[model samples]
Target: MYTGMRISEICNLKMVDIDLENRRISVVGKGNIYRRIPLREDVVYMMKEYVEQEREKSKFADSEYLIVTQRSAKMDRTAMLTWFWRLSAELGFRIYPHKFRHTFCTRLIQLGVPILTVSKLVGHSSPQMTARYYVKIGMNEKLHAIHLL
Candidate 1:
C-alpha cells in the first residue's frame, strides 16, 4: 500500500513475496502485470518494527503477510478504506487513500523524475495518464520566447 499498489494486490501480498534482502516488494500491478517496487528505508524500518511486535504477540504466528487482522487473516480493501476514512475523519482532513498516491506521483514529477519512470513506479499503463498532473511549475526555457517577442 505504501508503494502505491492497487488495493487488490496489496491484499494479496505475502511476507515471502517481499525480497527483504534486496529491498524490493513484488506487486501484481495494473493490467494483471507484475513489477517490483523498491522499499524505502522508512518502509523497511516500519516493516521490521511490525514484524517484531507481531512475533511478540503471536497474533501473526500463522500469517505471512505484512498486515493481519485480529483473526490473522489477510486484509481487504474494505477494511483498509474503513480504517482510512475513520482516521481521516478524526484528523479533520479531507483525505482519501488514493489521494496520497496521486500526491506521490505529483511530488515525483515536481522533482523532475522522467515521466516514463514515474509511470512505471505508479503502475500506470501509459505515460498519458502520468502526464495528466505534470503541469509545469516555475520557468521553462520555452517561455523565454515571450521575452524575445
Candidate 2:
C-alpha cells in the first residue's frame, strides 16, 4: 500500500485494474486524480498468492474484486480498521493506524526521500501538510548557529 495510494483508493481496487506485467496499480485518489502506483516485488508476490487462494475457494469465480470477505463482499474502510484495531490489541500496540502513517512519512524523510515525493505518496494536498509533521524534527538551526562564529 506504500507505493502512494489512499485507503479508499486501495479499497476500490479490483483484480482487473492491476497491471501485473507493469507492476503498477491504478488508483483514483483525492480530487478524483487518477495515477499509477508502483508495486514492490514483495507486494506483487503477496497479491498473486492472495488471488490464487481467493480463486479456489470463491463461489463466484466471476468476481473480479481484489479483496473479498468470506461471503465474497467487497471490503470497506470500517471493517478494515476493525481488523487493524483487533490485531493491534492482540500485539499489545495501543497506537492508531494514523500513527503508522506518520511514522512512514518520518522514516521516508530520514531516508533522504524528497519532501515533494513523500507528500505525493502520502496523498497530501500539498507539501505544507507533510512539512507540518516533519519540519519540527528537522530543526538543527540552533545547534548549527553555535559553530557559525
Candidate 3:
C-alpha cells in the first residue's frame, strides 16, 4: 500500500527494482510502463530485512524476484490473492489486494494531496482520471468541510 502498484507489477517485482538507499522502487505498471515510487522508511527497512533474512533462508535465494515461497518460486497474482483471502479470513474482515490501491488513493486525498500529485504518484494518465475514478469524499469529510466555516 505504500506504493500504489498494481498486483501484476508487485508480483513481477525483482530485487534489483528496489533502491533501498534511495527509498524507492521501480515498478512496471500497466502497458509495460515503468514508474518509480517512493517508499516509507519502515517499508524500506522491512524490505531490507526480508532480503537479508527471509529470502536468504529460502531455496530461492538466487531468485531475482522480491517475494518468494519456500519452494523458491516467484509469486504470481493468484498467490497474492490467496494470501490476502487467508489473512482476511483470519482477521474477520473483507480484505483484498486491489483494495489497497483504492485505500492508498483515498488516504492521499484525505491528506489534502492535490489530484495532480496523487495522479503522478499512482501512475494515472491524468489528474482527470485520478479525480474521476479514485477520489471519494465521504460523510466525514463532508461534515468536516461544513464545520470549517
Candidate 4:
C-alpha cells in the first residue's frame, strides 16, 4: 500500500531489497529495471516489527525472501491473491492486490505530486503511461478544478 510496486515485485522482494536505515526499498521492477522508493517512517517501523517479531517466528524464517509462506520459502502471487481473498471475505469488501497499486498512484496524484515524479516512483517507463493508466481525475477533482477556474 505504501510502495506502488507491482504484485510480482512485492512477492519477489528479498530481505536485501529493503534498507530500513535509509528508509528506502530497492525494487527490481519489470524488464529487470531497478528503482529506489522512499519509505514512510510508519512503514519502516511496521516492516521492522514484522521482520523481527512475526517473520522471525515463521517456519521459513531463514528464507531470504522478505515474505515467506509456511509451505514455501517465498510467497508467490497465488498465495498473495488467496490472502487478499480471505481478507476481502472477512472485511465484506472486494479487495485485491492490484487495487493497492492503483490507490497508491491515485493518492499521490491527488496530493498534487508531479506526474513525472509519480511515474519514476512507481517505475513507469514514462509519465504519459502513468497519466494514461493510473491517474484517475475523479468527479471531486473535476469540481475542484472548476472552482479554481
Candidate 5:
C-alpha cells in the first residue's frame, strides 16, 4: 500500500531487494527496469517487525523471497490472487493487489506530487501515461479548479 509497486514486482521481491537500514526497496518493474523507492519510517518499522517476528517464525524463513507461502518457499501470482480473494470475501468487499498500486498513485497525485515524480515512482514510462490512465480528477477537484479561475 505504501509503495506503488506492481503485483508481480511485489511477489518477486527478494530479501536482497530490501535495504531496511537504508530505508529503501529496489524493484524491477516492466521491461526489467530497476528502480529504488524510499520507505517511510512507519513502513520500515512495520517491515522490521514482520521480518523479525512473523517471517522468522515461518518454516520457509530461509527463502530468498521476502514473502513466503506456508506451502511453498516463494509466493507466486496465483497464491497472491487466492489470498486477495479470501480477504475480499472475509471483508465483504472486493480487494485486489493492484488496488494498492492504483491507490498509491492516486493518493500521491491527489497530494499535489508532481506528475513527473509520481510517474517515476509508479514506474510509468512517461508522465503523460500516468496522467492519461491513473490521474483521476474528481468533482471536488473540478469545483476547486473553477473557483480558482
Candidate 6:
C-alpha cells in the first residue's frame, strides 16, 4: 500500500506487471481496468532486489507472483490480513491493511500534490473520490492560510 495500491491489487501483482527500467507498475484496479503507477526510486531498487535475490533463492523461484506464500504460491488475502494482525500485535499498535493505502494517499495530498495527480497515482476513478476522502485540511495548513491573509 505504500504504493497506494489496494491490497488485492498488490497481492495480484506479477513479475510482468512491473517495468523496472521505466519505473512503473501496471495494475488492474476496481473494475479490472488497467492503470499505470510510477514507482519511486527506492521501490524500484527494492523490487529489483526482491526479484533477483529473494525470489530467485526461494523454492518457487519460477513463480511469477511478486509476493508469495512460504509454499511459493501467491499469497491469499486472508494470509495477508493474518500477517498484518500478527505484525500489529508485535508492534503494539493497530495495523490495518487498508490503512497503508490511506496513508499513501493522505501523505501525497498533505504534501500539496495536485488532486488529479494524486488520484491518478493511486488509481482512483476520479479526482473527486480522492479529494473527498484523502485531501484533509490540517491545522498547520489552516494556520498557513490564515497567515497568508
Q: What's the lDDT for all of these models?
A: 0.76, 0.73, 0.87, 0.93, 0.91, 0.86
Candidate 6 lDDT over 1-149, as tens digits, reads 55888889988898898999999999998976678988889989998998889877778777788897776468778889999999999999989778989998888877888999888888888999999998778899899999998
Task: lDDT for model 2, please.
Answer: 0.73
- Against the true structure, candidate 6 has what lDDT? 0.86
Error of model 5, residue 133, in angstroms: 1.4
Candidate 4 error regions (>4 Å):
138-149
Stretches of candidate 2 off by over 4 Å are 138-149
Better of 1 and 4 by TM-score: 4
- Candidate 5 global lDDT: 0.91
C-alpha-based local distance difference test score of model 4: 0.93
Predicted structure 4, TM vs. truth: 0.92
Worst 10 residues of 5 by lDDT: 27-36
Q: Report the candidate with higher TM-score, 2 versus 5.
A: 5
In order of appearance, the predictions have TM-scores of 0.82, 0.79, 0.89, 0.92, 0.93, 0.88
Candidate 3 deviant stretches above 4 angstroms: 138-149
Q: What's the alpha carbon RMSD for model 1?
A: 3.0
Sort the candidates on lDDT, descending order.
Answer: 4, 5, 3, 6, 1, 2
**Residue-wise C-alpha lDDT for candidate 3, range 92-125, written one tens digit per residue:** 9989988999889988987899988888887888
lDDT, candidate 2, residue 35? 65
lDDT of 5 by residue, 11-107 (tens): 8999999999999999989987678999999999998998898889999999999998888888899999999999999999999999998999888
| Model 3, CA-based lDDT | 0.87
